[model samples]
Target: MTQLPGSYESYWMESVAGADHRALAAGLEVDVAVVGGGIAGICTAWELTRAGHSVAVLEADRIAAGVTGYTTAKLSSQHGLIYAQLLKSLGAEGARLYARSQQQAVEYVAEVSVQLGIDCELERVPAYAYAESSDQVEQIQAEAEAAREAGLPASFVTETGLPYPIAGAVRIEDQAQFHPRKYLLALASDMVGRGGHIYERTRVVSLDEGKPCRLTTEGGATVTARDVVVATHYPVFDRAMLFSRLEPSRELVIAASIPGEHDPQGMYITQEQNTRSVRTAPYGTGQRLLIVTGEKFKPGIGDVSRRYEELAAWTRDRFPGASITHRWAAQDNTTTDRLPYVGRFHPGAKHVYVATGFGAWGMSNGVMSGRLITAHITGQELPWSKLYDPTRLHPLREAPSLLKLQASVAKHFVGDRLPASHADSIEDIAPGTGAVVRVEGRRCAVYRDEDGDVQAVSARCTHLGCIVHFNDAERAWECPCHGSRFATDGTVVQGPANRPLEPRRLPTGTEDSDR
Candidate 1:
């Protein structure tokens, strides 16, 4: 999920793939062609199947391999600091509808878990949006007021079992959590068995969101469907200018499984800047304590190494007995306002639906999206569609971020063409350090560390042949376009690109081999 190793990394993959019965080739058309197999896609498929519509899901990877598996899996009505902010920006009516939709989604998850006999360890619990200081306590009051106006049982909580001090918390009862992968896996099985098609490793190159949406695949297959759902994490086919309207944020999660455990039975959330949330789930007969969640950082913006260390220290101080088992990071789409984008991709296109920009609480909300969109596509009146309409324009607080991203993408694509050699020379670089070098004919990027060694890698990124920039924080070469990252050792860390940075040896021999 985080594109790195963790405790459940190997076990999680084997377990789900063994049970999933799906094919990879593109076949006949269906009522809906869902582009992603994450929780949103599966849930949508489930809803479509129940509605007696045939749906086909084309996934770039296995189900739950995207942001869905990477999520913190909290099905809470309390999206931290959301309702309060929404009330201020979008008014009481907007806030109330948003809260109702989210809470209803939470209830539906528990309802469906029992209905389908899905043993996802679903459990109801209390959730807190508390402040650590008295000044911040007013935040809880404001939030509670908004929640009440929204017809919810919310209040200020002065007391909590956490060792840390807090002024107050806004408590929302009956929020839930579960193993996300388990639930999605079960849904995938049901989708497959009930005539819904899922294809793994089948990346959608583009989607024409026009009438009778035509989806083109990277492998030269076309699926023409009456309707299409673009649930793929970022929706590469941003025909709706979603990137500007919706921002991408990466979150870090580090979990330690306690040897002996007693679950607190409720999800706890703090109102700090970079929020931290905790919950207890079953690892086996013995319960596992998971201290998850942190806040948003644009891709490759913050220091990556610091992410792990901060969480490690946080766990060490909080639960001394718990031994670390899994540590990972996830990225999710966020909107400027608190609501998610769920409906038609854009007004220009017909019969294409999408559910994206879920903030970080997609387990319940995403499932609700699947249900609502499927209903609308099949010509049914879903109760919440008007409120969560994808094209609804809220206040443009996110306009700055969106504008900056578009400008950057534009600048990088043009700027990357100039050879890196135009800037630096080998003489300008210290030994054991790397620099872009200009020779008689070509340009190359060279790296050397304190070890008095030299390594050369192609300055051009594999994705679009644009020159790459070395990220000192991650010790990897980062592509300015699309956020592809490669380690200093030339291994691919993240993708859109499946290949590593090209190795450039010295004219005589391989420069890195000397090491």
Candidate 2:
């Protein structure tokens, strides 16, 4: 897809002031080495520390700068339509256990917030999934029944106060919302205070998942930990075919300082083609609601203009007078059956834990993942362990996901080599637009404004060398392969593309095909 990156609305963490950094150096050891600094890693570290075990968190960048940086940050157990589907796919016991686990996670956040005196805008409200179609209504009705049977407090509704048309909705009460960053920061402080070491900017280069796993960072640092938790959004252990087990989803988020009066009572989502979910928390003295909108499937193939327009329209329709301020987008890891994977890395591999595929509900699932993983490592009998195990059969069939990922790979890999006959310079592009400038047979994405200033990025996609598509609505270049995103100036906004876009070696006048 041509859509690049999403906007960066302030959700959760408020103060993440740290240096641009790297991985560990030399050799080190800890009781547990948590790889990833998002809510899951941070929360796990906190718990491990509280349990009196020495812990170390290794982050590839500043704290809270990954998918955790890009979440809607809704701290609730109302995963949309999950209970009914899980019951059908994994049985009723599995569904009820999953619901209880998520609810306990939500309560855990509130308890942690109160216990730690964190100021992350934690609020209790209802979560809803509005269905605008009769078929979806039937689905939600079954879902509501399943939810109630699973011991969750949920109901079906035909009368939502939304401005849009709807057939019915599934409402789960006492669901919650919060600022993700605040809670994470509070946990990070606790972790550090309890003698847990957090190594910022420490990108893990290699993982040894044998007994007493040895994790090596790029900087030659070897950390020997009894257990390693890979909460790195997508797992670093790709040899297990973990990437195929889950699908990645990208969403655009816009934060508007809307009038508090316009915010409907609770957090809401709909089953429209482009669904809309809303929640509001006090940003300052006045209220600013974070309208998290825009979800395009990963390897976003075609274009995103329609998607952005849909989000903008939703914001305008939902709260007309809202002042649009911080606009951002977040990409999430999703699984085929909608349930996340959280447990050991694989069946045979012990002591190498992973938590991934949280769908769009990272906040709660993340907390649950941390708790479950911590329990697993400690060999404790914890409730809900079976529901989140990594070795569980694909809750749904996997043929479709495997086919989809293979198709994406084929499509992008074959077309990634930049075209030979592309334009030579920024002068070739018109004002208020961009073009894929070709130089010495290498393609670079170039954009020129009304002033004729030029910005260029290598056309080669960072993931698998596929060319990237430039998205104008968000002004970031998106890789059609695996959804890597780059800023117009070649900065890495997202990955599977782990590196920034390469810059041109010469001026725009160089022949694109000369190389």
Best by lDDT: 2
lDDT of 2 by residue, 290-374 (tens): 5656555554343455676567666767677766666666787776567788888887877788888888889899999888887
Local accuracy of candidate 1 as per-residue lDDT tens digits, 282-313:
67656565656675465645355566666666
Clash count for candidate 2 is 20
CA lDDT of each prediction against the hidden true structure: 0.71, 0.74
Model 1 TM-score, 2 decimals: 0.83
Per-residue lDDT of 264 in model 1: 51
TM-score of each: 0.83, 0.87
Q: What does the lDDT read for residue 268 in candidate 1? A: 79
